[model samples]
Target: MRLAAYGLALIAGLAVTGAPNPAPQVTLDRAEAAPGEQVQVRLTGWPTGTVVIELCGSGGPARCARDTSAQIHVPGGGAGGAPLTVSVPPGGCPCQLRVSTLDTRFSVDVPLLVSGAAPPDSGTVRQAATGPPVVVGASVERDRGWPARFGAPARRTVVLRLRNEQAAPAAVALSFRVGRAPSPTGFVAPPAVPDLAPGEERVIRIPVTLPALALGSYEIHGEIVTAGTAHLVVVTTDHHPWGLAGLLALAALTLLPTRRPRRSIGRR
Candidate 1:
């Protein structure tokens, strides 16, 4: 019953955003490999003046290689493309190849399983604990036209509403970075407001001065972080009636007695 509530809450969150759904983009076309041999990884993408490609081994944070390149120059306003190579290690453990846009400073993660490893069996992986629950959504005024004043820019008010749904109060902090294509070079102050009460929300209005040169696609991400707290969202899986019935049957068996305990061997 508790798990079902979490699912419903997650669904409701989507409705509140009202923002266009955006999907992560990957430029890597394919990974080719031979038995016990090295494989070549090729990636292609956009807004490309310069970029970096990193290779991580066995799903761990350990980086095997960090290759910086300026040769990925897009031609005739074409999409970005680049090719890099990584030697397959002795074992068949899967590896992760990450690509980062140098100028725009965005990153994408891709997983590459080693050649000839057995396919994984069908199963479900569930998070053991739900992390700190932080609600996030963005707002933009569509009808408001861009102001044309030429001096110091006006402070754009960005209000982040944070609600602590846990039983106890939480200390919340907000950290954000400007999206690519007009990224904020310098840091912003008071990354977040702290000490939010349970079942309570605080709207943090950050006054930001847009650079005169700022333009185009911008994105802001906010997260609430605390020590020893789960920082990722937890989602509940669906429960079927058959599964519930099975549990109920098992519970009944615990109460039933076999052969009535020999009728207690009563006298008379």
Candidate 2:
């Protein structure tokens, strides 16, 4: 009789506090990618309803543009899962890919690395003429249309033009910086140009990777040091729309004429 009473009490407690629900989850094939790269994603444990997927900037609003989001319907009471292919978009930045169900309050957030790409060239070499004994040439190569906006990683190439004026061969060291920080990994280092003949000029191409950064203005600086000569080059990334809007507001404020101090006509 005591065992029966205890079992009845346990059942009543369970009925009052329902069972725990499994949380929704999402997984990506990779964690990092350059802009325009394709990534495979798998989702499971969602509630029985339509699900919304979004790729939003880190700390930004929840809903992204249609180009960066997708909607999938899970039928048969959400018993099955769904597989999705997401393409990284241009103007890359650190972001999160979120998945949420319509009926229940179940959601999942996945961190994604959206690396940056170089901007197009303006048909002229961008460099400092007064630095060291090297000339710098930087260009971004991107294909047209979908590839340009949603395909492979854009290629960034930096060409260094060097002329050895000294009689003996010189050992040159090269370093690169992005924004105010050092270059991130996965970038191909500049090749060493040792034993450069006297009065010989050689052009070396260095491949650079522009990782995703916060939406702002960034400067990429490259330096070549050899035989007391230091060649430096600085390139600026194109300002994002938000950054440009801030600049425009600042400029408008500066242009606004300040009210002249009211003249003391009564005193005069």
Candidate 3:
């Protein structure tokens, strides 16, 4: 029975560790295009989530039209594709086609050269400069923690600050996860955020429950997806559950205490 218990412990530990996931990728049909031209994009090995694709210029802020951006849904099994068709925004060249999941599970920026774009000067290319309609910033009260705090499981709320930079109101959907990254199917906790007025800012708080004895860092990903762009803020939190695990191990060992060596009075 003791051997069996040890074996089960080993298995349980392995299960908690989990297997590695295949890295997500984005494959573009062409590398360069003229402004107002369409490019096809294929997503492979991406996990299930809602991803936004947009054609954005290279400098200043992301410049893409609300009508040209596309959102794709990757289904179950990590095997999904989206044949995204996006045209290079007029004068938004020397730009990149940006793709990112709502939870930031997969993010890739594919660069492209657009016709009529100013030639490079000293490694600098000029293009239309504009700002994205929406952007986000993230921070937490505590960035690192132990397994427990004052006898309770350590937990924290990630505070997200969002801004609408456009002159018009922007409505955005907020999706976030704070735990093991790129979960096979562990999508949850999509906090609702009110729409922002022009030049308006808002604050959102997402609370996450940290595992008491699970080892490793936790990922705090918050993304705000508007019609034209999806911006993500990725934060990593360090947690040491080793202290709790060690205590548990010690308690288990105490249940089968080691026999003390018999001391002979003659030795004294």
Residue-level lDDT tens digits of model 3 in 1-268: 9999999998999899987777877778888776567777787777777766777664422244335666666667655454444555434456777777754456788887666765323433333213334446677766355436323456767777777777655646556666787542333355545456778878778776665554567777766666535676777776665666677888898899678999868754
Clashes of 3: 0
List candidate 3 stretches off by more than 4 Å: 1-136, 142-154, 179-185, 210-212, 252-268
The stretch of ten residues in a row with the least summed lDDT in candidate 2 is 122-131
TM-score of each: 0.31, 0.34, 0.43
Query: Which residue runs of candidate 1 sit more than 4 Å off their true CA positions?
Result: 1-131, 140-148, 179-185, 228-268
lDDT of 1 by residue, 1-268 (tens): 9999999998898888776533335545556443344444454434433334545554222222322211243333424445555534222246656655433245666776546653332333211112344666444322132342322232344565667777664644333433343343333333324455667766666544444444434444333444234243211111123434556789999889877555567688
lDDT of 2 by residue, 179-250 (tens): 434442232345544445556787777665444433444456766654334567765553233444566789
Residue pairs with backbone overlap in model 2: 115-212, 116-211, 116-212
The lDDT of each candidate is 0.44, 0.53, 0.63
- C-alpha lDDT of residue 13 in model 3: 91
Q: Which one wins on TM-score?
A: 3
User: Would you give me the overall lDDT of model 2?
Assistant: 0.53
